[model samples]
Target: MPKRDWITRLSTKFRQCQQSPFWHGAVALLLFYLPQTAGADLIAEGRAIVAEHCTRCHVVPEINPKGGIESTPSFKGMKHLADWRRRFEVFFTLPPHPALVTVVGISEERDKSRPAFVQEIKLSVDDLDRILAYVDTVKN
Candidate 1:
């Protein structure tokens, strides 16, 4: 469909729906429950992905406190930092993390001078989004 036509049709339907009792109830139920379910699912999947890839290096507090280097910061600890959101948003572009984590499409070339003793992690842009979403919910 043409972009303008599609948008017009959508707006027209939305306007029609706005006047319906069923619409209000449905929208209310969705507004009340959807975020809880969707956000929880995103966080849960992010946690699983982090457990599979990130726990190898970063701490996840109770989930994997002793899993990685003792000096490494936990997810909650990182979450508390002032630039935590920006840092996590572009973590794959940062030093050390880039060496360990590879974003499927954006990662650059790496040194192969020495044989890798540990496996390199692979993540998609979607996975990165999930990680940040999960990290956002982490508490001190």
Candidate 2:
């Protein structure tokens, strides 16, 4: 039950399991590596994430040139990737969900005017990076 012995036993068990059932081995490998998928380039993943989350509020022209029901910030015209990277870097860093307060410092009135979806939208560090990568590719 030493740590090294435990690992050796675990490895032996894993090899035995793999020999008995290839499908189970494959599934175990998949589960082990699944979280690694988050590291993919932002442009591809970001666009998809934004399309699903942002289109409801903002006029995400990449997804829809015509725009959505509510009028929020125009991601099309704005320097979204750089702007958003900075915004999110600050938003996620502070404790206790200080995003609203942070937004107030930049553009208080404008923040108040944001669409409902925009207000509720939250992104993890990886997701934010991906979103910025996608937005950076988009030109006005």
lDDT of each residue in 39-140, candidate 2, tens digit only: 444467888977886666567776877876554566765664456657545543444334332232332332455543325455565666677777776776
**Per-residue alpha-carbon lDDT of candidate 1 for residues 80-108, written as tens digits (9 for 90 to 100):** 78999999999888777766777878876
- Which predicted model would earn the best TM-score? 1
Whole-model lDDT per candidate: 0.82, 0.62
List the candidate 1 regions with Cα displacement exceeding 4 Å. Answer: 1-23, 109-117
Task: Output the worst ten-in-a-row residue range by lDDT, candidate 2.
Answer: 101-110
Identify the runs in model 2 with alpha carbons over 4 angstroms from their true place: 1-40, 80-85, 88-122
Alpha-carbon TM-score of each model against the true structure: 0.73, 0.45
lDDT of 1 at 14: 93
